[model samples]
Target: MESTAKQDPTAFKRIEFLVVTKNAELLSVSKDLVEHYKFRAEYSDSVDTVDADTRLSSSPMMILISLEEIEGLQERMKNLQQLRAAFPRSHIVAMVAGDESTDDCEMLRGSGARYLVLLQEIKNSSKLYYLAALLVQGTYIPVPVSDLFPSTQVNFNAYHKLVLNQKFLPVIFSGFTFSDKKYRQLETAQQVYVRREELGEYRKYIETYHDQVGAALKKRCRVMMMSLMALYSEILLLLSLDCEAGKKDLVQSKVSEFVQGSQDLGRYLKDCPDVWNVIAKALDFQFCRYERGPYILAYAVYISLKADWGQMQDVVMTALLADLGILDLTPESFKTLQKKNEKHLKPEELERYRHHPMNSLNRVMLRELEVSNETKSSIVCTHERNDLKGFPNQSPADKIPAEAQLIHFCELLDRRVRASLEDGILTHDFVRKQVWEEEKDSLKRFNAAFLDKIEKVLVA
Candidate 1:
């Protein structure tokens, strides 16, 4: 014959418990039970008028109720039935102090109470906590008297059914607002999705907020200017990279794209004068120096003519793209070149160095960037000297295009200022004086019309 010995009723483990009772002694008993069970627990002291709204939202693993405190068993049963409806699988343990009538026990048992612990068995704190823990763990402990209370052996089928029906919609939508209530309602797994959704929503919210603030808004314009300044700082860092390894080309290409994209974005804002004003503010913030000041003014002209003169736009775009080539040159190579004696270079090496601007121009042409024949002519003449001393065709003043002459002057000014700053020359006024002393005569050779624009932007 097979052995028919029953398993120990209290040998199960529980994780979390919620105790609900009006009696302070019962609350104490429940707390003691939770501790003995080796489980984490929380409790509500006012069971008769307990805030079910808050408790239900809390969604604890198990609820413990004292049966002796119920004045009307039927109403309490209806309320418990509703709670079971909301949280189907949650364990409900009812504590009974004395021997009850069969009807009373049956009433409590029918009302979704999974366990009816007798007062005598729970005299010690350890046993009560252990029982509560077991209830929370969802372990099926046999009722002390199964024949008298068959319904005490609750199943998790109702809870699983409710969960399947609800899906996970509540957790998904709760992330938009930052609230403690929202946080508490979600489990750890659910919170992960909430956080991801919140990030995406936050990005969109900020973008919309910026649009609503308008381009003329001083605060909004300041932020845009600050962001562009940061981008320029990143550009400076990228410009310092090694070009021989080909990494410089990659950085230059990215910068070129950024410039092109920003120009295109500016075109879209032309109809919105307020937005255009903001972009102008950003430009003013970025090009505060004499060298950058010319390029800034030129860029403003290019943007202004984007809609009116297609050919001019193409020319300006090409000139903008050409700046990337200079950016692609290694800082170390530039420094070494600056230190070398220009007079010592043999004819062949000097010839090669003279064609560096043309080499850059060819690369841009090969990329098929939007540029006109006039623009290409301008780009080729960027290095030509007015005194007929510059190379790659040693063109005289009349042969050089006005746009190219202006760009050449701007480029030289930028290089000189940058070189002086790197050498720890602190004062801009001193740097300007030194640069003017060296290049004042050469700069005078620039086309009168082109020079006037440069002077207005830089000198005025």
Candidate 2:
């Protein structure tokens, strides 16, 4: 390690820190802190992987270490001692287990730890931020950061779903108010995504009420939805592993869970437009270009529109199973084919691709999942356009059901958004106006009322 006496005055003002731990959750949040708040950060997975001299070479102003048992008590203490000896001037915030006692906390503190937080605090962003701020300012005490939040949550007054948030559509999509096509735009967008206000737009809707009852309900809804997504991913992975031998009961059971649970969640989100809209947006954005993306997006769109629970379930069922017929195609190859213009494909290949809707419907029927006639119609008509431009069958605008129209609109919107994210750059003003134009233009080919409903429930 370099001599500390030669350090310049300006060097003292520039704070950098090293975090040592293998905890994914901790590492993730720490990274968020570093990027969003502009902190200097370095990471080491475990004490053994790094030497004290190497750790101190950079002369970080602080060190953040976790309490997960590493080689036992004495060895862990020895590691801490080495870090303290190497950088005597730096602070160490040791994340201890939740079950740690006052004595244990004091012992770690006595062993050169400057601050302490319970392991559970890692999940609470607010607490993490509070602690980080305190430590940076050289004001944090060696005590646990627990029960810091007020019993009542802050009011959900971030923005109006049907009005205010529409202004931030492009910002929400890419986190910046600049065109993603430019270098600066992409860089800024990534940083801007973590701003509290940006997150507030989504959180305000997800949590419409700040009261205890509303909070409890919100937690339940979020957890259930996450579980449903996990189930979908698991099912997709299993099917891919062995299409014939995939666990049918598991898939059916998980599907049943999502369907049954959605009834209550659907009703809960009916009046909370922002909550469900963001939920749908996130589901579509994160999972797009994958097998389950469309399904989750359809489910989100259905609930956001305040459709009946039974009807929404049918939409989800169709969405999840709609692409099943094309499962045999390699994803890479399928994506490549999709990238090509329709006119470039051979007639037989185009015909084969177009028949996937019917194939999906047939596959679900073979599974004997008790799908409704309405669900069957949705599945078969997923590719049908209101302007008679769709493949397999070209149904007129009036003939397409509102349900099918909603699914189609969502599907197209996700594809377009993903494309923009990849190929173009946009700011809030640019994207909002663009979305409005596109939605208005869509009226020529889609049902006016259906398009209006979509814009109101989603974009607005």
Candidate 3:
């Protein structure tokens, strides 16, 4: 039996969530479930009341609405759309009757709902509340691998017989998975697989819930590492599946998010000191995982400098596409450059390598990306020096962008660190000495103002 008493209005004070439904039973259950998960929520009898409540100081972080009415499903969906328009950042969960048509589920998804919860299942199962908690918090939780997926030993027929519900399970961290042992960290990307599924299912999941999925996956990774993974995976896709227009759009969208996230992280890290070492260690791990050492090095320094949002965006775009020209090189030429030693390259190889910045700019243009003029300049001038002694074009000191100057210094530092690592030197000590002691004079190759910013970050 469910309580029918109206929840006291005073209970809504300081609440961070709202549950909207005409059913008194659902109101009682939802209130209990949310409070059980340590979230305070207020109940509303209808979406109309929620619309009025939006004028309050703090909007709810999540809105759970019941859409089980077959007679007025369309009206309920319109209410959902209105709520979505009003609270764009709120996580909208639409509760259905589990046995609804696929078309109805799709409509619910299309109506701006971030999650679809079966009403009967929620009422009967304790475990489903945990899932609801995850949806509301947008946080990661490690679950047994078997709980989230069909048995790895299952045959084709047996696997097919399993429900498609597993596809909706948010079980992975980017390309990797965890061991079933209690809350273990990620082991390897190779250990996970979902076999013989139609691509449509994957696409549908990505379209509807990719952002929330990524948010839930952010446990060990902060913004920089996430941005690196996004760029790395999308670039791999672009390289392999160049014909996929949808992938290209995804890449562009991810780049924009990366910029926005970087801005947010920059503000957060500005007040913290001596935290860069920990961040560097995490970045080094990502570098090893993604095989993107230069990007990691540039990113580590880039975030530390705490550039304005506009400059950060331009520099990040440059860092991502600066080396894309290496993709155009022959395998042998690419391998030569991968050594991070230009002296080893033959004259022809060296010439081609020098022209890679221009090639990268050309690649960006060919991709039809909507980058700003500043970003274009940064990519082309990434290798140019303020001393007027660098690059294929030998662009003058005044011609270089400040964003390009920072990237150039980081690239130079990355090569130095890699060379020292090859000689069995510790990276941390080498970087400290190289930046503060040996590179004091070399810093003149960058703009004085830009170098001052780097100096402050290093000393801090």
Best by TM-score: 3
- What would the TM-scores of all predictions be? 0.36, 0.46, 0.49
Q: What is the C-alpha lDDT of each candidate?
A: 0.45, 0.51, 0.53
lDDT of 3 by residue, 118-140 (tens): 55545543323433443444321
TM-score of 1: 0.36
What tens-digit string does per-residue lDDT give for candidate 1 at 287-405? 23211422432344433353232244444544554443433332222223434433655665555556656755765555444456777777677778777777678887888876666
lDDT of 2 by residue, 138-198 (tens): 2211111110122223321221111311111122232322232433433423221122212
Selected candidate, larger TM-score, 1 vs 3: 3
Find the candidate with the highest lDDT and give its number: 3
Q: Model 1: clashing residue pairs?
A: 33-128, 33-129, 34-129, 37-129, 37-130
- Tell me each candidate's RMSD, in Å, in order: 29.3, 16.1, 21.1
lDDT of 1 at 16: 44
* Residue 267's lDDT in candidate 1: 45
Each model's backbone clash number = 5, 5, 0
The better-scoring model by lDDT among 2 and 3 is 3
